[model samples]
Target: MRPDAVVIGVGNPYRRDDGVGPAVVARLRAAGLPGVTLAESDGEACALILLWQQRRLAVLVDAVRIRPPHPGQVHRLVTAWPVPGPLEPDRGSSSTHTVALGDAVRLAGELGRLPARMLVFAIEAADLGYGAGLSPAVERAADKVAAEVAAEVRTWATATADQGP
Candidate 1:
């Protein structure tokens, strides 16, 4: 069977690191993988679930605000997100309304609509003000994260191919 998967780059381009996800999609387009479908999202739950239907895997990329160990760190989540508490509303740039990427996955699971496997790439942002440009730090980090996302995609494709019946 052919491998079926989708990579969802989730963010708004004008909002610093929030653009990382979309940027990855653009990079992947240039890389030209044969079997994968790419979708650009605003991290909206409806759009993600719709795009992910029946796919073996879905990779989501976006900007995040992490705590302590590395307040401003780029990170990846390769499995289900740990359950979170009530979401604090965002004052700056985020691509969705009300719910977020993490919550969406959880909600999907609740609704029996979750994908087979899911992964997330989240980069720390220095700023998320109303703007069309990225901070120097976020810009550089996006390039690195995009490479990582591409490598992960290649690995997923290879592994899926190897598991043929």
Candidate 2:
């Protein structure tokens, strides 16, 4: 059976704070949220689209580098399909990926493969250098983001259940 929701963690774990996405996935895995599929990606556009397709809800966690960085600040947004441009305007194409998430989102919109709802949780990074661990602040934020994702999954599950088959 297909999962009701998927959480795609987009980043490279070896790149210090860029690993925030995977870190959150790890937490969710340990928590074991029912009917929630957890996945990690290197922010590849096509891979990302494939991961979330046909799900009722898709949640993505990733790292972003913004000016005057705040190491662990979390930015959350719900994308409107057929997006006009960057997911976050002021941040531009700020994702720490070769092909931005916004690009994948745009492609999904064009292909009409979007999930019923999509949410993004972008964490600010303090370091992107090659390493295995996230910065202290980013580490803490990862825990928080995991909790947030878990809550979201539960809420989605409850709402869907309430609607009945």
Candidate 3:
């Protein structure tokens, strides 16, 4: 059976703050929201597309490296399905992924494989250096972001249920 929604965590845990995505996923896993699938990706475009295909909603959590670094700031963005056009990566921030999330969204749009709705939660990073754990600020942000994602999933589920079969 298809899940009502999927959350994709895009980042490398070994890369310090880049691990925020996986960190958020771990929290959601513990919350155990029904009918919501959770996945971790290296932020590769194809892998991301596959994770979200056919779902009603997709929520992506990732890390963004911005100049002069804010460490733990979170940014939320929603992309309309059948995306109007190719999305440019967030201004002043670069993805920690090999392929930017915007690129994946564009590819999915072109392939006609986008989910009905998509959300991105990008956390600013203080460090992308080789390391096994997130920096202190990013860790705190992870907790906050996890709660936010859980709330979003619950909201989506409620709305979906209200729509009826």
List per-candidate RMSD values in Å: 4.0, 1.1, 1.7
- Candidate 2 or 3, higher lDDT? 2
lDDT of 3: 0.87
Work out the TM-score per prediction.
0.81, 0.96, 0.93
Q: Each model's C-alpha lDDT?
A: 0.70, 0.90, 0.87
TM-score of candidate 1 to 2 decimals: 0.81
Best first by TM-score, ranked: 2, 3, 1
Provide the lowest-lDDT 10-residue window in model 1: 86-95
Please identify model 2 stretches exceeding 4 Å from their true place: none
| lDDT of predicted model 2 | 0.90
Alpha carbon RMSD to native, model 3? 1.7
lDDT per residue, candidate 2, 57-146, as tens digits?
999999998887888999998999778668853554388998878889999988988999999999999999998999999999999999
Q: lDDT: which candidate is best?
A: 2
Q: Clashes in model 1: which pairs? A: none
Better of 2 and 3 by TM-score: 2
